[model samples]
Target: MLDRAGYDRYLAAFNARDYDGVADFYVDPPHMEFFGIVITSRQELKDFYAWLHDNVEENVRVLNFAASETCTAIDAIVRITAKKDLTRAALDAKGATGFFPITAGVVQEIRQFIFYTTRGGRIEKVECALPPMALETV
Candidate 1:
């Protein structure tokens, strides 16, 4: 059985770009990275994640979800629910490592993610890999 509730909460914080909440989800700062860019410190990781959320033009909504081996993967469709008109100023003010295009429909995006967890215990680390959007070609 999958711990859907717990997974949902974790993803909620992640989707909201609550870097502090995300950090607290981890126990000892489990390794996290994006295309090989490693994140170690909680503050550094939070800053990195915050930058990502600020840059991105969309948010996620869980469509199909699953969990295995302490990892919770979700296949969800992202909607560009909103776009900041002041994006230019925001970017100029803070900047970002990278940003993504707001897509339509339920594209198959599997959130390959892992969390440090134990029975009746809090997670020690949380990491996720959001691979490039992949939709069925056929």
Candidate 2:
């Protein structure tokens, strides 16, 4: 069974932008699905995170969470501040508003639903659902 403390630790690690710490919560070769893109290897996951860290600054606030014997689901609001201009294609792919141009330092809030399946107390698989971006005027 997934414990709340364990989940909290994961969240804390993630919010700290500690990729290595976050990776420790997952099994090697973890499976992840995000915005219809599937990442099956740990190396790929690390690379993806590296790219994200380089592109934007982000923080997540969990609004709700539920856990069962094998699965945990989290509903969160992710605030992202772009460090560079985001292309329309990239915005559209993430279900974000494509009409508004995303320039540097623009904050975008994304409602996210994330589900995790665990084995031996480590995350085995992750599936994430992201809605369209809601840009907040600073």
Question: Compared with the true structure, what per-residue lDDT tens digits does model 2 show for residues 28-121?
Answer: 8899876545668777777767666677777888899888878988888877888988787775665444234467888877777888998888
Candidate number with greatest lDDT: 2
Backbone clashes under 3 angstroms, per model: 4, 0
Q: State the local distance difference test value for candidate 2.
A: 0.77
Candidate 1 lDDT, 1-138, residue by residue in tens: 236787677667877777787676665554654434467678877886665545344456676666654555565655443223334344445432233233323222334333343323345444445555532311
Cα deviation of 12, candidate 2, in Å: 1.6
CA lDDT of every candidate:
0.51, 0.77
Q: lDDT score of model 1? A: 0.51
